[model samples]
Target: MMIKDIKNYLKSVVDCPNWYVGRIDGKKDQCIGVYPARSQPKPVPIAIGGVENTTYNKLGVEILIHWGDAPTDAEEKAQAVYNALYGQNPEIGGKRVIKIDLNTSCPVYAGVDENGIYEFVLGAVIYYER
Candidate 1:
C-alpha cells in the first residue's frame, strides 16, 4: 500500500509517464522505479502513563530514473522528482504524509545499466500516519 501510494504520488507529480513499483520496465528506456528501502516506526510519548505509541511510520524509499543513453535526461528527471517530493507533506492514497526529505542533497548517478540506459538514484525518507 505504501509502495502504491508512493508510485501514484510520483506519477501525479512528475511529468514522466512510466512509473513502476519494485522493478523497472525493461522495455521502456525512460522510466522510473519506486522501491522500498528500509523503514521504522515513529513512536511518541503519550500523556497517559508516559507510554509510547506509534502514530506514524518513517519509510525509506528509493527512486530510480533511467533514460536511454542520456545522462542529462536521467539527471533532469531525477531532479524533477526530487523537487516534487522533497520537503512536502501531502495526503496521498488516503494516507496523511507528514513529510518527505531526501537522504542526499542531490540525485546520485548510478552509471549506465547493461541495456545502455543511464540511471540516477534518489533516496528519501517519507513520514506518514499509520
Candidate 2:
C-alpha cells in the first residue's frame, strides 16, 4: 500500500531490519545457490529466492522493486533507512522474521563507485534485509 507500510510488512517478514544496500554487475558475486524463475503478469516477475521467512501469503513478492539495487554507504544500514521510510513494527515480536531469497535473476548489488557504497534489490530468498 505505502512504502512505510511495505517497510514494516517486510520487517515483519524477516527478522532483520528488512533493508539492503549494494550494487550488482549482472548477478556477479551475489550469493550462494541462487536460482532464477518467473512470477506472473505480462512483465513476468522474476523470482530470485524464497519470500521473506517472516512474511505470509507472499505479500512481499507483489512488492514493487525499489529501495534496493543502489549504492549506499552501508548495506545493512540501508534496511534501517528503508524501515524509517516504510513503517515501524506495530508490536515488535508479533512476528519474528521476514525471509526472502536472492536468486540469480534478482541478484543483490553493492555500488563499486569511488565511495564504494553497497546496494541491493528486493531479491527472492537469499536477498533479504540481512
TM-scores, each model vs. reference: 0.84, 0.26
- Report lDDT (CA) for all predictions: 0.82, 0.33
Q: How do the residues 1-130 of candidate 2 rate in per-residue lDDT, one tens digit apiece?
A: 2224444544544444223222223333222111122352133243466444423322222222222234342445444434432323232224323343333333245344333334443333212221
Residue-level lDDT of model 1, residues 1-130, one tens digit each, is 3887888988988887688999988678889999987553344345454434556666778989987787788888889988988778888778898988788999999999888999998888787776
Q: Model 2: residues >4 Å from true position, as ranges?
A: 17-104, 108-110, 113-115, 123-130
Using lDDT, give the best candidate's number. 1
Model 2 worst lDDT run, 10 consecutive residues: 28-37
Error of 2 at 119 (Å): 1.5
- Model 2, residue 98: displacement in angstroms? 18
Residue 11, candidate 1: alpha-carbon lDDT: 93
What would the TM-score be for candidate 1 when compared with the true structure?
A: 0.84
